[model samples]
Every structure is written in C-alpha cells, then in structure tokens.
Target chain A: MALKGWKELPIGGVIDEPGKSREFKTGNWRVLRPVVNLDKCTHCMLCWLYCPDMAIEITVNEKGKPQMLGFNYDYCKGCGLCADVCPVHVIDMKPETEFLKD
Target chain B: MLTNIDLKKAQAVTGAEAVANAMRQIEPHVVAAYPITPQTPIVEYFAKFVADGVVRTEMIPVESEHSAMSAVVGAASAGARAMTATSANGLALMHEIVYIAASLRLPIVMPVVNRALSGPINIHCDHSDAMAERDSGWIQLYAESNQEAYDLTILAVKLAENENVRLPVMVNLDGFIISHGVEPVEFLPDEKVKEFIGELKPVYPLLDTEHPVTYGPLDLYDYYFEHKRQQIEAMRYARKVFPKVAEEFYAISGRKYDFVEPYRMEDAEYVMVALGSTNSTIKYVVDWMREEGHKVGLLKIWMFRPFPKEQVQQYLNGRKAVVVLDRSTSFGAEAPLYEAVKSALYEASARPQMGSYVYGLGGRDILPEHIRQAFEDAIEGNLLADEQRYLGLRE
Candidate 1:
C-alpha cells in the first residue's frame, strides 16, 4: 500500500481499518515457539484464554464438542505465556531454530 | 432534539455555578473530574445535578486529576460527549493526559478555573495554570466575566466537537475572582442549547464493534512527524471553524464573539494586550486615559490557543507601541503571552514597538491604577531597554 501524507491520516490518530494488526508480522520477533502435546491435552482452553496475542484457536469435534487447535503463529510473538499457564504441562516452548531443524 | 429555549431570564451566580448550569443544559454523556481549589465548585454543582436527575450524565469522581483526564479520554474515544473541570495543581496533575486527549482528538470539553501555580502555593485568580498548558494543542478560550464563562463553556463543546477540528478545548475563568464572585448571568434554555450544540457524530469510535479501531499506537520515526503535522492542520482548521460556530451561537443568544476583541483600537496610539479578567480593569483604565486625551486602547484576547495572529496584527499594526500584560511568568524566559504576541507581530509589514510586563504571579492583585501606569509607560516608550517590566510588585 502507498504511504499516505500527513493530511491523509485519520483525525485524532484513529486507526480506522479493522484487523490491521494482522498486517504486522509480530511472529518475526519470536525466538521460541510453543509445541502443544495434543494427546495429554485436557481441553480446558486455559491457554486459549491466556494467549495475549490471541494466537490460540479452538475448534469443534465431530459431535460439536469443543477441542484445542493449538497456536497460530501468524501474529504471535511466541512469549511462552500459554506454556506458563498450562495446567498439565501439555505445552512446551521450543527454540524456533530447533523446531525448524525437526 | 432541539427544544424551544427562552433566552430572557438572568440569574445571579458565581462563574462556577454559571458553568455548571451550562453543563446541565448541554447534558454530556460522560464527565470524569477530580476536584481542586476554585474548580471544585464547578464539578460539585454539576454532581448535584447528576444526583438530582436534572441531567443524565455519568459523573466519574476519579481519585486524582490524572485519572479524571484519562477516564475522559477513554469515554470520548468511545464516541461519547465527555467533559471535566480542574484548577491550578489539579491541572498540573492532569498535564500528561491533557496532551493525550488533544492528540487523540477526542473533543473533550474542560473548564479550567484559573489559579496560580505553586512553589509556595496560592489559591487565587491568575493564568499560571492555563498558561502552563498553552502549547498542549488544545483550543483555549478565556472568559472575562461570569456570563462569558458560562457562554464559552457551552461554545467550547461545539468547537471541540467540530468534525474538521476534532481537538479538545478549554474554557478558562479566573479562580477566586470569577469562580467565587457572584454576578448576573444570562443562559439559553436547555432545548435551545441542545439544538445549538447538535449531536455527537464520532468519525471512528472505539465502541463500534463491527468497525474496530486502534488509538495511541506506537508510531516511531516512520509516521510520528506526519501525525503531528495532522494535528497542526486541525488547529489551522479551528481558526476557520471557530467563527462559524460562534455565529450560530450568536443567532440564539444575540451575543457576538471574536478571537481577539479590540476595544477602542481604531485610532489609538498605544495599546495594551491582555487575557482573562485583567482585561476588565485594562478597559476601564483605557476609558479613563481616553477622557484625559491620551490615545490608548485595550486588546483582549478571547482565544489564545490558536493565537489569532492575523487579528492581533490587524489591530496593533499601526499603533505606536503595545504593552502585553502576562499574569504568569515564564521563569527564566519572557512571559508566554508576551512572546506569543511579539512573535505574531514580527511578520507584520509595519511592526509596532512591543514591551512585556509580567504581573499577578501567585494571585497578586492588579488594580486599575497599575493598568493605567502600564498603558502610560507604553505610550511614553520608557521601558524599551528593560528586559521585563514587573507590574504591581512591591520593592
């Protein structure tokens, strides 16, 4: 997108476009990525609730039951907040380089 | 929702009460304020209206002035008509958020009951508090009397809410002199005021769930300068928008207002430029001087934030000399009003000889005689070499 001049900006510094946060790839700043162990997951959705970046997604099962879909790294900075808040140690923060090597 | 208003009745009340009456008539959506000396009565009176159901305003009695300003910013950003009042140290406390509100362009209206800023601390009439925030990018209107205090408060809401100039506005009234002193004030009826101010149509409200928005984001070198340029453009827009709004207000009230009010400046040889309640005494002194065959007049600055450069130059260009009366000292530097008026005149084709006098610091009393002497000194051009002339200060 072309950069707007000073006069073209919205009044009062208001960012009018919805979901413009998606344009900023904060995932580039992530050093560690969360690896979720789906087998031992309790489906408590605590990590989904605690994810500061709203990276965690929840999906519905065949019977319309809710299930954890782990994290989406598009906008997440991988702060390990979800790993810290997990009840059963279902998630672990792994170095991004190590995950890439795997 | 414009109701039929009666403009004939007048009530005797203090400036604070007058402003409160205006607030009750306008009936803003939110008012978040912390009480301080002199400004306390304004919010206190409005709070009673809230309690008594006279107005359906959500009054947030915040713990501190900072929080009060912050709450107003939040409310205003959410597309609500928000307002607050403060004085002296309270204004000092809300200093940070004051700039934020303006930069965010929330259109929050505030009444600043002017009082002296502290070192030893004073609770009297002075412009130190409002002067401290002169460069905060808010539109400032100074009131010389209780009636003006009430009128300007109502008008400030309309000015700030203007789509082209979506900046915060402050109405200043002298602390004890105007806030506490009782005087006769005429008010427009509630329905007429509602029609005059119109409705609050926010461009991009945070509360609009379907169309989301972000405010106060981190804009570094990439766009910070551009954003500041946008704010300046808005201020420029205010210079044009103010008169249009004032004209609409005049239609209802039959009282006309201008950015700078020139009193007897047409053929005067010397002029005195001042702000706030001091102009009243200066006008009286000018009349006395005129009777004595002295060609002197007074220029009262009703709007100080936009600075009214062209209007000021228009009135003072041909004058022999001009004296600027500043109630607040700039400490080590020249007084704020003095520096502003002097710089504004520098661009004129024919610049008048200018002098600065700093007076009434910490609520020092300024008598008519003191103003008379200032005008006389300006006419004589006696203090041309003096850096700063001190007025009414005991040696």
Candidate 2:
C-alpha cells in the first residue's frame, strides 16, 4: 500500500548522534555461526552438497577413514545450511552478537 | 480538492494510490506509462489529477512498459523529473532499457508492482517478477506494507537523484496486498513535497547545448566494460546513501526504516527471512510467538539490488536458526533469496544453521502457522522442505 507524503532529508553529515566516539562499520559483525559435533556426524556429504559458497570442506583421517568436514568462516554470514542439512544433528548455531556490542 | 495533511502524518494506502500521490508530490515533468495490472490504477489516478489540473505534470500515455521506461529515461537524461509504474511481465519486457537507464546514470523512479513471473501464467504476487530483473543495475527496494511503498517512492526519487547516486530506482510492492488494498493515506501538500525535493539540478544533462557531451557514444571493449565498472561504483554509493537517506527521512517523517528491517530480533533465537507481503504475515506470527515466549523474529529485506550484504551480515549474526522463506523457486538450484542469505552467513565467522522453505509460489497465501512449521522444521533439524507442506494453497 502507499505511505503518506514526502519527508525531507538533511544533507551533509553521516553520524546520527552528537557524541559517539566509535564509528561502527555495521557489516563487520557475523550474524550466524555453525558448530560441528564430531560424535553424531556422518561422513555423508549433504552439507557440502548444497553449500552455495563452497564454504565447507570434507577432510579424511590419517587412516583414510571418513571424517566430518570443516567450514571456512572468513566470508560466512552465518546462514546455517551446512548445519541444517547435516544428516546427523552435528552442527548448531552460535550467534556472533555475544562479542560485538554495537 | 487537495487534502492537506501534516508533513509527518503516517497512514496506509494502496500501493497504487501511494505511488500516485508520491508522483504528484515529486512533480515529474513527464509520466509515461502503459496500463498493467496492479500498476494500472496508479497511472489512472495520476491521469485524472492532470486532467483536473490538480497536478501540473505531463502524464504521457505510452503503448508499453518498455516505451514508458524508455520515455522516462530520455526525459530524465535531459534533466526532467521522470517516473512510471509496471508489473510482472511488463517489467520483464522493459528489461532492455532498465539496464541502460542505470548505466547512463538516469535518475528515473519506477514503481514495479511485484507479481509472479509467468510461464504457466499466474497474475498474483510472489516476487519472481522483480527478482527476475535483479541484475538490471537499478536500485531495488521491496515494500512490505503500503506505507513503505509510498515513502520508499519518495525516498527512491531522492536517492536516485542524489549527486553521489544517480542510478535509477525501482520501488517494488506486492500486487494485490498493497496495490488493491486501500487505507487512510495522508497526502502531503504540493508545497511541502516541492520543498523536500528542492529544485531539479542535472549535473551533466543530455540537453545542455553549450557544453555538449555525447549521449550513448559507442565504445570498444576497452572502455565499454569500464563504463559498466563506473555503474558498479555508483551502486556502491547507492548502498551507502540508502541508510543516509533513511536517516534523513526519519528526521522529517518520524518513520524510520532500514534496507533490511529486523523486527523484535534482540533476543530472537528463531527467525524467518522473506520479502514483500509475506513479511507482514510473518511479522504478525513473530509477535504472536513472542507473546508465548518463543524467541522468534522477522527480517524484511527492503533493498535487494545492492543486496545490503553488510547490513544483513550484522543483523542476522547471532540467531540460533534462520529459516529463509523463498517465495519464488530458483528451479533446479536453491531459491535466490535463500542463496544470498546463505552465502552472506557463510562469509561471517559466527553464523547459525540456515534452513530453506520454498513456499508461496504461484500466488499461494503464506500463513502464520506455515512460518511456525518452518520454525519447527529448523528446530527439529528438518532441513529439506516437504513436498506436501504448502502454506495457503487453494485445495
């Protein structure tokens, strides 16, 4: 539906509050975290199968036995598909907000 | 009669009416449009205003959405406030000129009534129509409610016309939900809208006779792709200018909105991610679930073209489970929204488990319980969507 009339936008300043020391780069914080459970994990590759970013990598043990995969968190935005599709309920969500205050 | 309301007065109106009023206030020099479902009444009302001398803008009746967008692109390049509206297949048809409008930095504002993209033809809302043109270079803004549709239209004009961001902007509204539904809308005074917009100043106008700059000059591969690279830089400016513009809008209107809205998400453990009308329903469900002590929230994506990557990464960072509600299917691949959110989370170190549900395809009404079911699915580790589970399908 349509909203009410137009609102005026003030030009020239980026900071909203008057006395804020820390300028926040809102994009720096991660929203979603994935944790892997080595016990319940199956070597079945479903998490790697559907990963759009190819963030998950499957590793094998020294004895060549199938082992659980690991994820690259550098570019991950915390969308938990790897955790979601893990046949074994091996991965869980850990939010990133616990550390970042802003 | 022109009904004058408070500058800060907030109310809900149909998407069509909201867009029409926004156009009236913007005072476009030319409004070229072809009547299409959902977007038809918007132009119709604007036509009436022009006929009755209520609005002093030239309302040009065009044969197609392509022509409508083309006419506005040309007019805008020549330094005129130009705007139009279209829906579904009509937007798809205007695909050719849409990219050109952005590449040339033509600040034309168009309201696209989000409808299902066709094959086995459907004429209702989903998001396939808008999502289909995601890469068209236009700054995409998805509106959940009517008020957002209207306010975003104004913001679209302001943002698109900004010196830093001279790309075209498309304010998307769901077909029936916002287009047909009417509510009490406070129409801003023409003087106030003019005041807000100020005078139109074209930086490198096409019509400048004294300092003539070539319009659409042919370039070889050497400079051709670089021109497109400049367009990318302008889009980066669009991402930054969106929140800056929103902050200014909040200052005057007292209504604040972000590129992506996070609702009751401070301590939310379970979240549903979607866009358009579905967000409204999701919000209601989130509120209900919240009262019952279930930690649930909703993230309504308003800006899609620039993708608001940084903002989304921050807002959705700490949730336990994220259920991406994809309204449109990506055929054999995962849904588009689902893919974007999933990728963003993957980039962040701290991310939650992401589950996807392909619901509300072909105009199906996604309900509150369906969202609850998705939440349950996320919690119980039911990742794959069940074929039989449809939200508001007609039996």
Report the C-alpha lDDT of model 1 over B1-395, residue by residue, as the tens digit: 00122334777799899999999998999999998999999999999999999999999999999999999999998989999999999999999999999889889999999998886778887888998899998999999888889999989988998888999999999998999988778888789999999999987888998998999888767678888898898899999999998999889888778898888887898989999888888888988989999999889999998989989888888778889999998878888899888988888888788888888887888988888888878777775623789888988
Query: Model 1 compared with the native: what TM-score?
Result: 0.85
Worst 10 residues of 1 chain B by lDDT: B1-10
Give all TM-scores, in the order shown: 0.85, 0.75
- RMSD values, in order shown: 5.6, 23.0
TM-score (second chain) of model 1: 0.97
Docking level of model 1: medium
Off by over 4 Å in 1: A26-102, B1-8
Which candidate has the top score in DockQ?
Answer: 1
lDDT of 2 by residue, B1-395 (tens): 01223435646567688888888888789899998887788889899989999887888898888898889888887778888889998998998988788777788889998888888888888788888888888999988777778778887888898888888898988888889887556655667667767777886666776655555644444346656666777788998888888887766666677888888888888888888878878888888878888888988898888988887888788778888887777777778888888888888777887887777777787777888888777667666532323455556
